[model samples]
Target: MNPLTAKRIAATGSAALKLLMPGLCFVVSSLAAAPVSEVAEQFDRHFEQQLVEHHIPGGVYAVIEGNQIVRVRGVGVRARGGDEPVDPYTVFRIASVSKTFAAGLAAVLAEQGYFSWNDPVVNYVPDFSFRSARYNKALQVEHLLAQTTGVIPNAYDNMIEANVLPDRILPHFRQLDPMCTPGECYGYQNVLFSLIEPIVQQTTQKDYATLMQELIFDPLQMATASVGMEPFMNSANKAMPHVRARGGWYQSTVVPSYYRFAPAAGVNASAMDLSHWVMAQLGHYPEVMPEHLLATITDKRVRTVRDLRRGHWRQFIRDAHYALGWRVYQFGDEELVYHGGWVRGFRADVAYSRDRQVGLVILLNAESNIVSELSTYFWSKVFDAIHIAEAEQFSELHSTEDD
Candidate 1:
């Protein structure tokens, strides 16, 4: 009726719209957020199926997102026909995954001026030698961690596997010929890689195990992480390594010789402890995993000839390369930092995406091809979940604009 009354009614309507808009936006945002628990449950189901299909005796895995462990689970028994079930606390030998720790520790020590990655190995271990005088003179600390020492790949693995003492193996480096100049090629190493132990020992006046405990395990509160066969076997919650027999998995006797190459393959830990290790690697704990140090260790130092198309989720992997102690894979546009380990009957895989702040660690007591398959499946699921959440958020934003 009256002009003034009409204006007052219009103002009240505008105020109500403003008040309601925020609640509406809140609802839309909530709808866009992915249900993490649901995704985790789905992953658990898939993982369980995989364990059964692969006939794995025992396994444990941890999935990490940002600073949190989103999933921590285990399937199957600790030993074939044994009543003990695998769980987050059950420890397994991480094998060559231990090299990642060695690289990280070297980076930390380098930052503190203990040694440089490029420092000559001979400077630390003056007795170090190679059949080729050129390689003997040119070999640097970085070359060892990168597995680019120009020595034949796994040249001494047979000896190591045969239970030859590492100290005895050390002097035999003079007997093996260099395949190329140091840092020119990629070669997977075990005995030569353990040379980092002597370098670390000489620089810090402490053994590699003590250094890892002081720098990594202690700070991250990885209570179950340790190096050496004695501690691993003596631990109450350790998994018995297993191997596939004629028709099924069977437990294997512990081999103590690998402990001598502690820097390369001796670290043992549980999935629960490794979740924290992954979190630190993902930059959750800056004090423990300094950005510069991480950057140094994760630098793409060498190219690998690994074919991604051979795996189940081959479509996602574009290329693969090797960083110091870790492998880097191009997954679409994102980079996956990964490493896999095999020692006797045990197998391990660890991987993380820096951009997504997501990671996975899988440990199995029985040797099998399941680790690679499960890794691919796990990453596919994670990327799918992230994409779905993003799509929902985009829809919500556009709908709000139209309204």
Candidate 2:
């Protein structure tokens, strides 16, 4: 290394990252930021190779260590037909990854006494009728975000996909009987989960989007993040969605269906924005996302045994449960907090290991299961590194004691 550059790094008195600028150059805002470690470099190479083999037109992934973006890259073009290159700022529809934001907002409001988790959903949206009044009254604010309302899994999700407005679709809940009472069972729902929107709006007297922006996004400095379809469509650097067919990859227009449920699947972000989000969850931005709020939101509330059978995740995930917006997995002896999103033409996966102070976000324009495989591969290798380090430390300690 040159003396000038080495002197700069040494002066920082912290780990300096040497990022591989394939094409894009990201400026490290702080001198203390860590460089791309061997594992991070390997993960990036494996991910890019997979995207090429899978024909994923364009995507971006960011790796975060502590409060630093150690490594981030954009792979491929914005669309299959375009010459526009993707970048760390190329926004993609994060889909259900939006749930984490919703849950985070709820945690923040609840912490500030805007509302309590124990508050009933009926108190805010009295029109949220169900075939069973007992279950209707029993459903609380926590159940909406926790996926434990005991309603049928993905209840009315088809309707949402059919372009049915939530107002029209939600009333249909009264026709069906709930499988179990609130908090008794785990049943994922885009419509039911989004009920948190009305509850928060009513409690805070602010629109859901504004609340998310003021409370979470702005505080974390997620500059490229925005909510709903209009903002995504308006953004000039957004990654247009894509669909894979037998012939090749094809571009697809972003549908307005899922955007109607803003809390469930309606947020746009770039890899850079998500790096800040990861840092907040890792206890870096405590003023915005305090450790208590993180704990409350990620606290396992319902067992999701079905997660153990997921395509690429089944083997590594020994146990699985749904927290408010996140899924907690027992990967060997470690805890993996994760969430994955799939909307029409996009797929996103975000996972972080708090113990290791590491996080990763993968955003893609195509609807492929590669996101899952890539994330699973990453966590597996991360855990492997942890094991090696611990073993080495143990051996060195014993050797010293013997001497």
Q: Model 1, residue 336: what's the lDDT?
A: 88
Candidate 1 lDDT by residue in tens digits, 1-403: 4343344346544311111121122111111123445556777888889889888888988888888988899899888889899999999999989989888888888888898888889998888788766677689999999989888888788889899998788888898777888899888899888889998898889978899999999999899999989889889988998888888888899998788899889999999888998998899889988888788788887787654554653555656777888888865445789988888889999999886677999999989888888887777565441222243464565565436
TM-scores, all models, native as reference: 0.85, 0.86
Worst 10 residues of 1 by lDDT: 22-31
- Model 1, position 342, has a per-residue lDDT of 89
Give me the displacement of residue 202 in model 1, in angstroms. Answer: 0.9
- Candidate 2 residue-wise lDDT, 233-276, digit = tens: 99999899898777678998889999999999998999999999
Worst 10 residues of 2 by lDDT: 24-33
Over 4 Å off in model 1, which ranges? 1-38, 307-310, 313-315, 385-403
